[model samples]
Target chain A: MSQQLAVGIDIGGTNTVFGIVDRRGNILYDGKMSTKAHGDITSFLNELKERLDVLIDKVGGKDNIRGIGVGAPNGNYYTGTIDYAPNLRWRGIIPLANLLQDYFDVPAVLTNDANAAAIGEMTYGAARGMKDFITITLGTGVGSGIVANGQLIYGHDGFAGELGHCIVIPGGRVHAGTGMRGSLESYASATGVMLTALEFMDSRPEQDSMLRHTPRELVDSKVIFEAAKQGDPLAIEVYEYTGMVLGAALANFVMFSSPEAIVLFGGLTKAGDMIMRPVRHHMEINLLPIFQNKVKLVFSELKESDAAILGASALAWEMKTDQKAETPQP
Target chain B: MSQQLAVGIDIGGTNTVFGIVDRRGNILYDGKMSTKAHGDITSFLNELKERLDVLIDKVGGKDNIRGIGVGAPNGNYYTGTIDYAPNLRWRGIIPLANLLQDYFDVPAVLTNDANAAAIGEMTYGAARGMKDFITITLGTGVGSGIVANGQLIYGHDGFAGELGHCIVIPGGRVHAGTGMRGSLESYASATGVMLTALEFMDSRPEQDSMLRHTPRELVDSKVIFEAAKQGDPLAIEVYEYTGMVLGAALANFVMFSSPEAIVLFGGLTKAGDMIMRPVRHHMEINLLPIFQNKVKLVFSELKESDAAILGASALAWEMKTDQKAETPQP
Candidate 1:
């Protein structure tokens, strides 16, 4: 038989990436489309289909493709819909999985991006062989996927793991759009880092720093990280503050779930020990005696470019395995 | 086939209650012994065995018993040991389950009291047929058991659920013995309620109230609850503050796991809407829009007297089923 493969699709606001991946997590063929270029859901689906068809053909054919899996914003595993994802231009819930399955004539599954990352970590990355762990994605906003008892927790509404929104500071930083204050997302996300940098600049107007040279609009997480690397005191303080908030939140999460490890994923982890050192310290200091020195804090092992695709594809493999378990021999 | 029964034991600092329970969760016979009177682990075990033997005999015989399950302070499910339970006179790890099994010639399991309560809630209380829910015990201290995906979450270390120690207020309400600050237990437990009442009194000495009639030493959770019921403003404010702190913590817990409901058990729930109204309000206010209306906050339906016995018994039933699954049938 031809090598079995699954199609992995990572849907983002800017671009949509699809790849043909082998069972071992190798992306054999890859394709991409501008998500914004498609004015409507129909056009987006058509473009995705055309790209996937070409990739499938290159990978031996659609017959060799076992199924398709998607990771999208606000994706629901139970209903297979993207429910009111704010970043997406789509007006309402989109039955993206069913649409993909209809086009490809194969089983399809979908979950939110963080859940996909968690599955990726569990199946082929840092969390391999671990029964309980949390994969925290620190990106444009904070998101989390919780794994307990070797199963990804999709609570009653398939939206169980939204650890980002857990209030960290209790009326501290307020998100402009969501009105959520003191959330871990408000302090730990890349946006949070940028906001912290801006607050520092405002608080200490007399202090000379490299961040002041850059325009307010241009100063982002990258600029702050670069400044901190060059030993800029203000930027260094931003990381310290960010990591302090993050570490405290992580300590609470450790107490809540007692995961073997909390794997950090996405952009903010790029700060490495600059952020991790303080996080580790605060987490240790804040933990209960029984929980202290037990939970591991580590970074995700998945390659950044491949992680999203791999995570999405892992869902397809899981679905294929579940189907086999349910079927009976003649 | 003869009816299957199991022994359920709740080991507290003052008393150790053991019961013979049928498969359907009925307590056929019950007995209790003064735990403090035993003075040592060996004597405690001897006394426990003697009492349990009498109860087991009344329930039919040893042949009718499937196994034993014990719930106690600091009980470790994986090791079947009570590790460093400060309230107990035992100085070190006590292999309670193994000791019981050796004397009874049957399998034995042990877990923390809160975990047992969670299993009981799942099996025979408000959480029946529900796959995801949290049982929060608000007695002298706050305790929790988190159930996800139809399985009790025993994390990598077999201590997954400890929501009580999750810090709600940073550098606040330090526990005298543990030195743990800002923990949910420090604010939401019966002790926390008493402390809050004391703080209110200290801060507002000029305010006329019913609480003043009771001496400062006499103030406790029960006294405060009764005073609140009588419409004392200061006492009423104490419950509001306690509920606010608790509700905020509960909101965070809801965000962490996104359980279908949070079942409150033990003394504080006795305050009813006086406490529940503020808790519900604060919990709703603090939650994200997506999480706000979806999760339920309900009081546990299990009877206080039977809950521990039922919970421990549920563990035995679970073990019996697990054993059946492992054994090969003839």
Candidate 2:
């Protein structure tokens, strides 16, 4: 817990991961525990606190901790609060950072998991060498973190990078964030891919797809991706459709941000070519007249823990460095 | 002749508008001339040259003119060129600013029209008091100028702020600009609105709609707005659809740039409430959780001439003043 080591916590819908990371992006000690299934907000924090106490005790105490950084669903960096994240049962606004700060007796910060990924990319992942780019996490839902002019655009508050919910199909399907129908998340997200696969199978039963042998509950995007790699039309179609949506949405992103590159992260993106080819093809086709030839789509090259932890740490690191630099050396 | 006035030219697909203006956002002289359908690029410049000669003569010879500021499609501020506007029938890059500089024997500058409008708004219009905002023009296509931290976001190659072509409705419609289908332009642009309106009227063939009498050639969003105001369900639907698309796109924009406001311009947006109501309703709803209670969406208050001309002039002013400020003067 020395001030040289910062605590990095990645609070997910299912698990809460905590670590002591140094300025060099090294995790010295780490621990994890199950999140409250009942969505009991205080109970969840109490459990995390108990685990953190063990880690702190091993490191000689809380006074040694410089700061705490949290990567969470619906987390806001500027406000340090978590809004309604359905995956977690917590309701209303939770002062996540403040809660951690109070229990740990150290400065703490919290931001969306995706924003943390972007920062992680900038500091330790595929986008490490870049100053301006977007990091997209193709997870349960599509989450993106944007870096422009070497800073995260927290946008008046901290909800600037909700890329998944932008309407990709205006009247297509009901999306979660916007309550609008047919967002990119509706068609390209992992769940969306599974839905497409099910529909494809139901609509075209004659297709001898490998996915036909997979159980319904286990019929997620990974099986579809594997089937596509082995040349299954139905599975390939799922990737194609997902890529098309991603490409179209990415093209729009290019017009707005003009970032140097776009890096994809998370499980769904692990399909790589199965996901990228269509995205690139469609992205190139839909980009602005001038932006057509520029901009590259690539995959994130960071460990999951690295992106989330580093990104969360970036929030505190950037803030601390900026503050320190601005303190006016007498 | 004097530094007080410069000739500002904005060349669009159909018309080439030229104006003589001073330091203030005032047009002392202005004229509109057709770009002359399909001709040599030099001929267009010659025609402009001849016009400038007459103006110089009117101002007691060439010494009375300061320089020139040109706003053209595909104009690159970094390169001082107009690089192929498809509708202009100019298929290659042309050193537009250099050509004018050579002709007038003084300084000249060039940039894309959207950027010009941004400068115009920043220096003299609704955004005069703001430093971070975006100006979106919903004409035949969607055009945008981004102002971030008090400067335009021209990325490494100077091609940034292509807001209209960003994907709002992925796979919704095949659109211009990169041939990516279903962009913001395809749904929210004037051309996009026309497509949506036609689709709207067709969707409700049996409805009591005023669009029944609207001529195809003269048909536009205005007719739809007037009808929507008069309680036409179909027309209201059109506006609602357009605004929702705009709002959804704006939410993404807010995430990327975190601008103070988004200022709407151009013909399609003139429908005012017809366009804004939906955009606001949808944008506010889908906004990043943090931006939910904050962020403002507004319309431009600058006349085209005032904003465009001023924007063009401001480009030149930025260049010349930047040079002056950098020069080691005794």
TM-score to true structure, per model: 0.96, 0.79
The lDDT values for all models are 0.87, 0.75
Restricting to chain A, the TM-score for each candidate equals 0.95, 0.89
Please state the interface RMSD for every predicted structure, separated by commas: 0.9, 2.6
Give model 1's TM-score versus the native structure.
0.96
Q: What is the DockQ of candidate 2?
A: 0.40
In every candidate, how many clashes are there?
Answer: 0, 16
- TM-score of candidate 2 relative to the true fold: 0.79
Candidate 1 per-residue lDDT, tens place, B66-107, comes to 878889999888788889999999989888877887888777
Instruction: Give the per-residue lDDT digits (tens) of candidate 2, residues A164-193.
Output: 766666568676555667767787778889
lDDT of 2 by residue, B183-208 (tens): 67888876777788888777777776
Query: In candidate 2, what fraction of native interface contacts survive?
Result: 0.55
